[model samples]
Target: MNDQNNPRDAESDYADRIKLTVALLGKNNKASDVMLARQLGRNVLLEELGAIEEPYRALQPYEIDSNQRDNFAVHTREDIVMVYSLAVRANEQLYEIRSLVRILIALLFFLTVLFFISVIWR
Candidate 1:
């Protein structure tokens, strides 16, 4: 029940998107991949909501150093592109993991069958 086109509405929406993105990103002990995925998700949601006038703001840019700014500049156009790329990369990685799990399951089944055969032959 937004008033539509209100400045506060825009800011609030932006804030909500940022919060949701942060939650989705969660923690990545290795890299900023999670953050990038969350930003991508936020962008997708914003596009769907028809409020893409501005991208969501970074949560804490002040804490990031100059060299590390690349990782925290989620508000820029190039940064948004990187977010999309990261999201796709994450999705592909998940898919690869699923495929590997399926293969392992099949392999385990085959091994169990072989074990039973050896037991019977003995």
Candidate 2:
């Protein structure tokens, strides 16, 4: 199980959330498949994050040589975005592992309750 007291874990999901927000904010891409993918991907990411606050806020653009904003600008730092992407993926794996553990715990609880009921009925 992950340590819930960890502040670092709390901040890690923000990267994925920012990515989702960016895709939703993207106005340049009009392709239906791409749009649908972005929506579904965002949905899945949200589900995986499990009730995050401000899950869809767009990242602010940063300073540069040109005054005009880029067409598909996501975040100020590309390097940080990449790092966040890696964090999101790593979090996904952790979620999967925790999910499996929860399933096993649920099954065990069910069996224990059944055993108690059978004993009481006897």
Candidate 3:
């Protein structure tokens, strides 16, 4: 029988959620897969075993350069979630615009062909 008090058991229960959190953070931050993997590995070793807490810590400010430090924004999980959600919506909108442009181009081509045929027949 699995012991409920075991940290491994707790981690197992939240593994999917943790993976999802990491994936969303990676997408939002435009991180490479290898970078994301490394961060996830480090997080697993460093963080407490349970629910994924504050996955955006990787995005926190680092005092590497004064200019970079000035631009750093401290974000919470909710903030990251909002930013990711907005990005998804924007991407969907861009897809819709591209589809509409394709449809319009097709219609224009059909009209041009019809006009040319009519002029040639006359």
Top model by TM-score, which number?
A: 1
lDDT of 3 by residue, 1-122 (tens): 12334334335434554576566765545464555556555554334322234334324543246543343333245557887999999999999999999999999999999999999999
- Most lDDT-accurate candidate: 1
Per-candidate local distance difference test: 0.60, 0.55, 0.56
As a whole number from 0 to 100, the lDDT of residue 41 in candidate 1 is: 67
Off by over 4 Å in 2: 1-82
In the range 1-122, model 2's lDDT, one tens digit per residue, is: 11334323334554554565566665455564465556555544443334234323213233333432341243336646887999999999999999999999999999999999999999
Q: Candidate 1: which stretches are off by over 4 Å?
A: 1-75
Q: With candidate 1 superimposed using the best TM-score fit, by how many Å does residue 100's alpha carbon deviate from the native?
A: 1.0
What does the lDDT come to for candidate 1?
A: 0.60
Query: Model 2 scores what on Cα lDDT?
Result: 0.55
Candidate 3 segments exceeding 4 Å error: 1-75
lDDT of 1 by residue, 34-111 (tens): 565565566554543444542232222224356545534544666679879999999999999999999999999999
User: What lDDT does candidate 2 reach at residue 104?
Assistant: 99
